[model samples]
Target: MLQMANYEFIRKQHILLGKPIRQISRETGYSRQVIRKALKSTKIPVYQLSKPKPKPVIDSVQPIILEWLRQDEQAPPKQRHTATRIYQRLVDEYGFTGGESTVRRYVRQLRVSPPKAFVPLDFPPGKFAQFDWGEVTVLLQGKQVKVQVFCMRCTYSRKIFVKTFFHQKQESLLQGHVDAFEFFGAVPQTVTYDNLTTAVKKVLEGKNRVEQERFVQLRAHYLFESHFCDPGKGHQKGQVENLVKFVQKQFFTPVPCVSSLEELNYFLLEKCISYETTTVPRSSLTVGEAFEQEQQTMLPLPPQPLDCCRVVSVKSNTLSMIHFEKNAYSVPVSYASTELTCKVFAERVEVYHGNKLIAEHERCLESGKELLQYDHYLDL
Candidate 1:
């Protein structure tokens, strides 16, 4: 290959000095064809390989490595094989005697090329949203505690709502949706999610889900549809998945210290509201501006929000306490040994006798502890 200096000299000789290609070649490298090519263009040519170099050692194990990588596409994200793991497997399982570096280079090449193609999805206003749960660590009253983050992102506007909860229980999940819908001031036509146990009882074949009964009730009350991503395909709901990370990094970074989860949630809510002025990518409109337009197309908020809770029927024991979630709560002595309905919420548990609300108490986090209200036992 001719250096750029040599090529430039040849071109200047013929083009600037008015010298013929034949004379230039004779004066420079004595190659008429090379001189003519340089004079024809001012740009320097970059050399490229006509074919990839051979990998003799890797060629034998190439098929095995490729098969493992293909299988990894369906495996759980954390369980997928690393290049080191693959190299070890090759050595142990196949008794290969190649350098690990060689296997690594070939593995990286296979992973980089032939990138997976994804169809670009476009959502119209009010079409859908994505929901996801993420975990974050925060200092609660000077103690480190891990909390579940509920994230919802509007598909078109990219507006987000984030809240923290003690757990991703069914009640908390339903309440998250309720709060998110109210935050946005309207419900979207559909919401996308992973096959979370709180929402999906069973993941049926291909996108179908046996949604939990409480989750179904939430949808019925709001008049919206629920869509579950395929198993191990978190990318299907990439919007909220990204939001989950964003909240952790942007909002919770440095590990917020608050007196209570309620105070932490207030901070999160303020951060979400402040994001409304931020611009969306590939568009000029701010998130709040886009959300304003989207609100027009969204479904109207129902007359009332859904009662976000889980109901379980339990009979009071001989001690005049009904057991729920391994915790017992007192009811009136008259209602002892009678079947009652317990509506469990994130913050509290309400026990109902027939149609009347009989007892309400703050939900206890620990198991095997009985919560007794003095008023409930006063009639004893």
Candidate 2:
């Protein structure tokens, strides 16, 4: 069989370079007839025909195999059977004698369409939203750091709220919901989430989830229903999942640099709000227009927002700094060698001495990081 490269080279040399066929044969090493054939053809060389493999065993079990593959459309991607597993099933259940490679080869040719059809989803205003977290890298104070970005998307408006946190712990998760609700100016009636550890304490059968206590508190306070996707089925909350990447790509691209995480998040929030004016997919209206309709159906904000702060009292070290979660923040030098109360909020840390606020510093996300407020101390 003539190889493709020789044919390509021959065609290129003869047709494009205006080289004669005898010279082409001398340079390419081909018969005149083969060269003539190559010159006449515009298409690439391909095998004339493929003979079907003989599969006596597979012939009997082919029906069974197709049924299982068809049923796999509904199975979770991880739980679906592999070619080897399917072969095993055929051998065990149907008493079929077939080589695993044959089964694998046949299965490779098999495919089923997605179980769910692609269709437009319409959400009633304020009726639905999606929440999720995405990992993003940012340069904070000249140090590169990884942070979790919490994303919430209103299903109706496609309006979004984005916040970044060093940890996806309960405190950050709850605080994200609190802040997002405050930003949206209303709470969605229903929120969808994958079985995120910060929200789900235990996964029950089917779509049931025993949510974390803090997550439950958030739901109760906001009076919104919480929905969890089936195991390995995050597509149910695809809106926020895409928004998570949207936040990372469109918002975090060029790798945002900021003096503090708080500053970076403020920039992201502005970007999120600005997205409202942009047109939504498959809809003629802008996100702001959709959200405006949603706002009417969305539940009203609570009289008081949840206390999303985590407060702890720590004794100030000789350096007049208090430590929390491996990060240290300085208070007034007078607080050195004294016990002070430190209240840690999502974006800042407040230090108090005997019920008097002494110092406040931007929250730090890294271990062994030190935050010192300029007004807290005067160097000797």
Winning model by lDDT? 1
Predict model 2's lDDT versus the native: 0.86
| Per-residue lDDT of model 1, residues 179-202, tens digit only | 999999999999998888988888
Pairs that clash in candidate 1: none
Report the C-alpha lDDT of model 2 over 1-380, residue by residue, as the tens digit. 68778778888998899999899888767889999988788577776747876668678888888889889989999999899999898888878777999899888878544576777787877899998889988889989989988889998889999998888877888899999999999999999988889789899987788887767888889999998888888888889888887777888898988997779888988898889899978889999998888899999999999977666888998887889989988888877889888877776788888789988887776789988776767852
List candidate 1 stretches off by more than 4 Å. Answer: 11-29, 45-111, 116-120, 332-338, 375-380
Which candidate's TM-score is highest?
1
Once superposed on the true structure, which residue ranges of model 2 sit more than 4 Å away at CA? Answer: 1-104, 110-119, 141-143, 205-210, 257-259, 313-323, 327-341, 352-359, 368-380
RMSD of 1: 3.8
